[model samples]
Target: MHLNYLANIGRYIPEVILVLLMVGLIILEATYKEDEKNRKYIFIATLVGLVATLGALIANMSGKAEAIFSNSIIIDQFSTLIKMVMVLGTLAAIYLSRFSKDIYESLKTEFAIMAVGILIGGFLLASANNMLTFYLGIETLSILSYVMAALKKNDQRSSEAGLKYALYGGISAGLMLFGMSHIFGVLGTIQFAGVAKMIPTLTSAQLAILMPSFVLLFAGIGYKIASVPFHMWSPDVYEGSPTPVTTFFAIVPKLAGIAALIRITAVFFVVDSPMKIGWIGLLIVISALTMTVGNVTAIGQKSVKRMLAYSSISHAGIMLAGIVVINDVGIRSVVFYGITYLFMTLVAFYITSIVQDKYGNDHFDRFSGLIYRYPFMAVMMAVVMFSLTGLPPLAGFVAKYNIISSLINSKNYALAIVLGLNSVVSAYYYLKIVRLMTLKPQESNEEIEGFGFLNQMVIVSMTVPVFVLGIFWETIMNLAAGAKLFIQ
Candidate 1:
């Protein structure tokens, strides 16, 4: 438990502040009428949330990896960096959620508590070194996500999204649990680093069992990250849930899941023998298929929300390209691309959230003539879309360049070419959004107000990270190339 205290007050600094602030707001509201007096509380909570998270991240950078709670949990640079991203993304989601008044007032306490609970899970995932710890983290995030998706009790779509996510998520968890049992049987240990050390000695028969277990484990991770074959849930969930919650799904959950995957696969996956050949080949095939299918199908989507959903899947494939290399560059590229992916996607979703909130529709055609309706939003949306397309001068392309260049250097140019061509294919649909907004005229001819100040808050805050990170990516690339949580 002392390990928890090293960052101690610093460890959950964000969670503690958010929870306490949320409690204060609820208690104050108990004594007051239904006035809009508590708006200040939410804004202050947002500020504290961001500050505490950033502070903890900075603090963690100076510390060594330590296992708290009798070695069940571990903290280091990798966990710290991933946690920083999750906290920042969650804060952005909270910021974009400023307009959700009724949901905010009615469920203020629950929302805050659940959000902190989810953060705890995300933190646990980052630091998780053992099977029990990983399971605990994944369950915590999943349960809270279900509740969040269902927060709109009056909306049937929200309820349906919750039901489907819970059902699919539960099955994935079960599969993972089954795989853990096999892993334990083969190695007599569930601690990942321990398993990695022991895995090198296992017999061919043991490797046979391990391979399927790997797939089952990958299924659970893929569902969480919305990777292909397990991505059936994303579009429905994204399109059905309220925009704010959907935005949350887009940002933090995806990052946490992917980061966890990188950590586990990089360390614990034992590729020791010829029998283990199957898993690597399987991953390579999945990596190719995920990129090709996600990009190809996304082109036909009419809803911008669903398009982004599929776009995320395609990007996941690109991230997996880094996974294929399995070296310093692969690891760093995952982190680097993960960084770029979060800001680009979150800002794009933020723009869509604001537009949908203002217009009461999210259809692709509705985006037509948006440049005429609100020029600022149109420009911001275009930046986000361009970034997502992996275009030059944006962080997305830089992310792709690093990953593909690394893969090619690793003598995997076939996969690199696939990734490159997919990027080109993806550009068509992403720019299609821009063309619609700029070229087509508004269908109704009735005017919509320029985004109000509150909405602009969401747009401007998300937009800065998307563009600035693209220009100054070198420092991050350097950091990522050298990042190793277990070492200095």
Candidate 2:
């Protein structure tokens, strides 16, 4: 028994490493003087630690799936892949925070610390095998996020964002707990596998009870993914938070929530039941509404950051579309979409953050005549925008294509059509930046300090993946094909 637990630790190394890293950063941070501006050592340590965590996840990928720590968590390719995506997103955010003026210099180290802590929560959520671990993961991710959102000490918007996030989060958590308790009371177990076992055997009366309980349960996950109705806070929070924190919020929590949602859908809905039917119906409505609401809302946004926030809500809707199909193909498509999304989102935010840092806001006009001063960056942003619009021969196209194809294969034609229409609607705002960058006259000839040669190279490096993944996506699709949920 002892040896088995020790062996499970091997599968858990990545998370352990991150916890240690967070603690080490805290200690290292204290050693520095309060007024120290250049915390190069902290930056170096953070990068090194994140890289090591990525390495650990890569190593875990090769191992067979297992229910570790007495099945409280399941380490599988699906969860591990999502963890890798989250880690990469974190890496990019940390690097961005290093130079971003949006966050206070003193709080930068704190950002790294909290990011790792949230990442740990994401890891737990991704692999969670039971209700206890699942709720714990959500709370852990939420608590840290509230602080990160308000990192700008003097900014009232930041404070408001944090407060709003906390209030909404508290409500969601409470509702989710209420749902979980009802589930536990009715089913007599908090273990997901046990719940699955009881689901198909549910009486009609029990089904009626569980249905609403599950909807309440979805409130928590849906809030995390920023899906509709529960997505009210996303834009305000995104606009109010530091850009780097917004970037992190876009990638990590959203992906983590999607991963958890996928697992719950796949595990609990496998056996046909009235509950499955109800759940699928609910997802279909939410998916369509989320996509429609997000795209329509994004069309009028002037702030590039807030626009991207609505856009992310729409993207979450697309990912939810993948889950609607409820098969290996759907899961594979979602995973592939997630991988491509990381690169596209990172590049877009990096450019936006850099531009915002220079101009004090991420208004659409800030990008006007960008090609005149910084052609490379303007082109990179254009590429990201095109990809985001689901234009051909780019990663976003392939990602969208995969999901549509999966939906078609499943005869889920209605949602697929909705996804298609949303992409078209998205083009207006996404291409708005492109038009501004190319067609408008230059805002200024002054060079953006954020677009230094090294930073441009980094942006280019990230953009290359967008192109490569579009044309050469088969390799990744194959990898995603292997990322199946391991249900016990």
Highest lDDT among the candidates is held by which one? 2
lDDT against the true structure, per candidate, is 0.76, 0.94
Clashing pairs in 1: 5-8
Give lDDT tens digits, candidate 1, residues 1-488.
24545444554454455556556645654654565545555556555756776786777677767665666767778778888888777777776665543244555445554565677677777677788988888888898998987777887888898889899899999999898888888888888778878766777788888878878878877888888888888888888877767877876777778777777766764465453355556667878898999999999998888888889888888887787776667778788888888788777877777667666778898788988867888898898888888887888878888898998898887898999899889999999999999999887666554367776776677778766778888886676556564331
lDDT of model 2, residue 271: 91
At residue 85, give the lDDT of candidate 1: 83
lDDT of 2 by residue, 1-488 (tens): 43487757889999999999999999999999998999999999999999999999999998888887767899988899899999999999999999999999999999999999999999999999999999999999999999999989799999999999999999999999999999999999988999999999999899889999999999999999999989999999999999999999999999999999999999999999999999999999999999999999999999999999999999999999999999888988898899899999999999999999999999999999999999999999999999999998999999999999999999999999999999999999999999999999987888799999999999999999999999989887786565554434
TM-score per prediction, in order, is: 0.91, 0.98
> Which model scores highest in TM-score?
2
TM-score, model 2 to reference:
0.98
Which 10 successive residues of model 2 have the least lDDT summed? 479-488
